[model samples]
Each structure stands twice: as C-alpha cells, then as structure tokens.
Target: MIKHIVFWRLNDTAYGNNKQTNADILKEKILAMQPKIDGLIKIEAGFDFSGEKDSCDVVLYSEFTNKDALHRYQIHPDHLEIKKWLAEVR
Candidate 1:
C-alpha cells in the first residue's frame, strides 16, 4: 500500500474565505473523492486542533493500493480541481 499525505497552512484571508472556512470546504471536497477515485482504500482530511503554533491548518491522509493508484488519484479531475483551489488559497 501507498500512503499519501499533504499538509497546508492557509493565510488568514485567502480566496475571499477565512482559514477555517477554507479548511471546511477543503475537507468536504477531499472527503467526497473516495467514491470517485479508483484504488483509494481510504481517505480523510480535516483541520488541525492541536492549538500548536506550528501546526498546519489542514491535512490530508490517504491510502492507495500502490504507486499507480496514487498517481491515478493525483491526476483525477476532482483532485485537480482541489489542487487549483489550494494553489489560489496559498
């Protein structure tokens, strides 16, 4: 199995949305991809609540059958859209 992880620290105001708001949207969009992407064993995304100064605002954890599966997920349309939004927010 392959594990794919991503972390994002969003600006206080980005893409016309606050950090928490963008985190919520990101969680919704990322979690909704499980059914659409093949070889996706599991996936989860959420805002961090550690209250640590160095913690990221949002994190994505995913498991795939293999590298090829991970590659497929990377290029999937839904994921591509999310990537674009993330870039804008960054």
Candidate 2:
C-alpha cells in the first residue's frame, strides 16, 4: 500500500469562516470521502490541538492499494471540489 499525507493551514478567516470552523468543516468533508472512493485501504483526517503557531490546521492520512488509486482519488470530482475550496481558503 502507498501512504498519502497532506497538511493544510488556513487563513485566520477564509471564505467568511474562522480558521477553526473552516478546518472543522473541511475535516468532516474529507473524512466522509473514505466510503465513497475506491481502492482506499484506510483514511483519516483531523485538526491539530497542539496550540502551536507552527502547526498546520488540518492533516489527512490515507492509504491506497497503489499509486493509481491515489491518483484517481486526487482527481476524482468530489476530491477536486474539496481541493478547490481548500485552495480558496488557503
């Protein structure tokens, strides 16, 4: 399996939502994707509670059967939607 990991840092207020709120919403969105996607061995998403300025607001950890599955997941329409929203927020 291949491991895919990502870290995100949101602006203090993005798309009219506060950082924590936006992170929470995004976390839920990401976690919800596991069941819909194919070839995913495992997936996890969460926010940092470390109270450190250098910490990323959110982190995603995923395992895929192969690189192709990872690639497919990256370009999947639903994934793209979230990625676009995240781009706007970041």
Candidate 3:
C-alpha cells in the first residue's frame, strides 16, 4: 500500500474566508473525496487547533493500493480540483 500525507498552512484570508474557516472547509472537501476515487483505501483530514504560528492549518492523509494508485490519485480530476484551490489559498 502507499501512504500519502500533506500539510497546509493557509493564508490569513483566502477565498473570502478566514484561515480557520478555510481550514474546516479544506478538511471537509478532502475527506469527501474518499468514496469517489478508485484504489483509495482510506482518507482523512484534520484542522489544527493549537493556533501556533509554526503549525499548519490543515493536514490530509490518504492510503492507496499501490504506487500506480497513488499516481492516479495525484492526477485524478477530483484531486486535481482541490489541488487547484489549494494553490490559490495556501
């Protein structure tokens, strides 16, 4: 299996939302992708509550069946969609 993880530190304000709100939105959006993607064994995300300057606002973790599965996920339309949004906000 392949395990993938990501951490994001969002801008104070992005997409007309504050960092905390965006972090919650980002977690929900990422976690919602699990059932839609093939070969995705597991997926999860969480928002940071510590409010530390050095901490990332959100974290995403996913598991895939194989390397190919991971690669496919990286390019999958659903994944690509969120990636695009992250680029603008993170």
Using TM-score as the measure, which candidate wins?
A: 1
Using lDDT, give the best candidate's number: 1
Tens-digit lDDT track for model 3 on 29-57? Answer: 88888888789999999888888889988
Better of 1 and 2 by TM-score: 1
- lDDT of all the models against the reference? 0.91, 0.89, 0.88
Give the 10-residue window scoring lowest on summed lDDT in candidate 3.
19-28
Measured on C-alpha atoms, candidate 2 has an lDDT of 0.89
Candidates in descending lDDT order: 1, 2, 3
Give one digit per residue, the lDDT tens place, for model 1 in 1-90: 999999999888887888889889999999999999889999999788997999998989999999999999999999999999888776
lDDT of 2 by residue, 1-90 (tens): 999999988888988889989988898888888988899888898889997989998899999999999988998888999988998888
TM per candidate comes to 0.93, 0.93, 0.92
RMSD of each: 1.0, 1.0, 1.0
Better-scoring candidate (lDDT), 1 or 2 = 1
